[model samples]
Target: MQVKKADGSDYEPNTISAFQRSIQRYLEEKSNLSILKDKEFDSSRTAIAAKRKSLVQSGKGNKPHATKFLTYEDEEALFSSGQFRDHNPEVLQRTLWWYMSLHIGFHARDERHKLC
Candidate 1:
């Protein structure tokens, strides 16, 4: 709870929860206490839960928006529009790259550097 991001902002609820889990694991491995199951840790668990709820209410830790997939008709339209044409080498290369990335489950932000 005392830690913050480099920009001095609070960590997201998911990150905080992960930190909590790590602490619990460490304590369990090194000591006899179990934050998850110990009655003594009930107040600590409640505090963490409340913090997570507060962060979520403030629009943090929400899932990312789902990526929209192209319908069959949309794909056909793109093909018809010459965007995915076999005749144009540049367009064909781009189309292949796009489809290959999707098929390989490469996230643009996470895998772009590795691919490049």
Candidate 2:
């Protein structure tokens, strides 16, 4: 199963793996067949595995990016800017966000609906 991008280019190995898993899940749900284990799909399974390995070797797999976090100086700057104060509603909300991010693991990427 050769999955391609919108531009007709090849998908990354990780993306291909995800697509394979999704197809495997659909097959299991509708036909009670396991593509990962069934003998009928041995060639297909090997092809996907070999393709993924080749893509990974060519650096088309997942890569880690540098993580960003508030430094001590950044925290000091925020405190000096008076944004952490609870007197004003806007500042209070920001303060609450900062505190929740630090204490309750509420990062910027967290869905807002999860807070409710």
lDDT of 1 by residue, 1-116 (tens): 35678998877898888988899889988999988889998998888888888889988887666578889999889889888877879998878877878688876776856875
TM for candidate 1 is: 0.59
| Backbone clashes in model 1, listed as residue pairs | none
User: Which 10-residue span in candidate 2 carries the lowest summed lDDT?
Assistant: 107-116
- Relative to the unseen true structure, what is the C-alpha lDDT of residue 21 in candidate 1, on a scale of 0 to 100? 89
| Displacement of the residue 16 alpha carbon in candidate 1, Å | 0.8
lDDT of 2 by residue, 1-116 (tens): 56678898777887877877999999988998988889998998899989889878877765655356889999989888896878899899888877876787754555545774
Report residue 50 deviation for candidate 2 (angstroms). Answer: 2.6
lDDT of each: 0.83, 0.80
